[model samples]
Target: MKKQFLTLAILSTPLVANADNEAVGTPLTAPPEIAAVFAGSAGTARTAEAYDVSPAELDRAIATFTNGMPGDSAQWAVALKKSFTAFEANHPHTFGAALGAFLFNNYLVYHDLPLDDAADAGMKSVIAQYDRLVREHPEDYAAADKEKYINMIMAGSYAAMVLHGHHQDKSLAGQYAFLKSAAGSALENYFKVPVDRVVLENGQLIAR
Candidate 1:
């Protein structure tokens, strides 16, 4: 059977600044409203049925990712990839929104930023890393991996839009359009593809 790959889900944890100035991880609780989103309760757009992954399972995966973190971005990326791969191997459904929720919470905690700021910065950081990998390390990214990463980033972006719309009382269409434009621009810049080649639909990224 073909396995479905999902995006990276980060666990929300308090990080202490260590001697090396790296964020050391500790368990942190997310706000109830935000946690509800991770539990697949934001709306029809965030339903577990929508992604084919149970909320409990996604929570388990999030915990696994959180507990495994060694701090710092490089190590965090490694941990995120490992967690994502493991979840993909075991689950029949996707968990991109769960991953997005984790990442969104982590950014809020790590940056001490407001929701809007955290979402904006966090999504950009993820897309930027993906862009760098495909542009500067094509030999390492691979085609399959590239597709998975793109899906994950876009799914994550969709989750962010859901959250923004829920909390900020914004229009989902507007949020999606903004995110799509940003992601489309990145794809065009890195792969020389047309901005319309990849599109977000029903909370997932579809590549043409």
Candidate 2:
């Protein structure tokens, strides 16, 4: 009986994973620099020497971002681009911070947020961010690995949209499937072990 129960538990595990993805996905906690970068975007740009925003304002912004569900993907995409751009411009020395911010924001919009708009800009940003990373820093292994993960998320979401009959255009579904397959193949080639799932808690992308 114990062995039979163990088999049932093993069989039930996939269901729980799927449920976790849809309901309460994984939460990504960022480091201090990345969190500061996000806060700077919402509050004020930090100086070369230090972050110089009003503590109250920054705190409030952080609360709103961390507490609220993203309303629109395109809007979040634009905000992310703006924030990352600002971070890079202000703190060129802390290059990795910008990347961290990008990854966090992208995951939020790409997966956790609702897909209300079909405009290409949101998806395009995902591709563009990765492209920029590889173009600017080809030798960085982290950038390459991140690109694979981004592609996987894109492909998986698109495939889900089609598989669950969410698309109005079958042709578009086919296109997304192709993109998904391409991303999957690239990810398999690039990373020995890739991230199998991505989950974000509400307001997880926004940081204080």
Candidate 3:
């Protein structure tokens, strides 16, 4: 059954649980107007899928999308590290590829993982790459767009991290608290104010 489930999960249409479905997880809800901006930008290989991905790469991407920094925080961070390294090796900018790397790698910051030198370097590289893209193509990525994408991903990732942390060990109250605080920051930063209420659609914020 375990093997069957794994294969099915991999082969299926990404197995994404709706954000509003508490059975899968509690996603961060943001103001409708603000949430709409973020729903368009989160996720690893899905939202930004222009690059050619191998079967193994596809598997990893599926894991990250469905798992969302659960027990696999360390593994997730490591995979993202390797992705960034390969992107750097390419020399030429594949905008979608770089953007995907940046979006996915940034989620690692919220995961409870100890990033080694390589992983740390990878994180820095993605940040640099994202910044360069923004700078070089302000017309494509305006300041508001950059802020929206970053905050939207942050809100969603931190919310998932908080849920996972609590589920893994109820005793780790401190960690969960920290994650909630981080989620709050992401919400406020993106909305430009603390949102009192939010609406979600398909795990993305629809209305506040």
Please give, for residues 15-47, the per-residue lDDT of candidate 1 as tens digits.
Answer: 111233212222234446324333422222211
Error of 2 at 190 (Å): 6.0
Query: How many pairs collide in each candidate, listed in order?
Result: 1, 1, 6
> With candidate 1 superimposed using the best TM-score fit, by how many Å does residue 102's alpha carbon deviate from the native?
10
Ranking by TM-score: 3, 1, 2
Where in model 3 is the C-alpha error above 4 Å?
1-162, 201-204
**Predicted candidate 2 versus true structure: per-residue lDDT over 76-195, tens digit per residue:** 334433432343343322222222233333343233233334322333343334334433443332222222222222223323333233244555565444434433332222222242
Which parts of model 1 have CA positions greater than 4 angstroms off? 1-126, 143-150, 165-208
- TM-score per model over all chains: 0.25, 0.23, 0.31
Model 2 scores a TM of 0.23
Best by TM-score: 3
- Write one digit per residue (lDDT tens) for candidate 3, span 81-177: 3443344454233332233232323233234333345544544454444444334443333222333333333333333334444556678677656
Counting only residues 3 or more apart in sequence or on different chains, how many pairs clash (N, Cα, C under 3 Å) in candidate 2? Answer: 1
Alpha carbon lDDT at 200, candidate 3 = 29
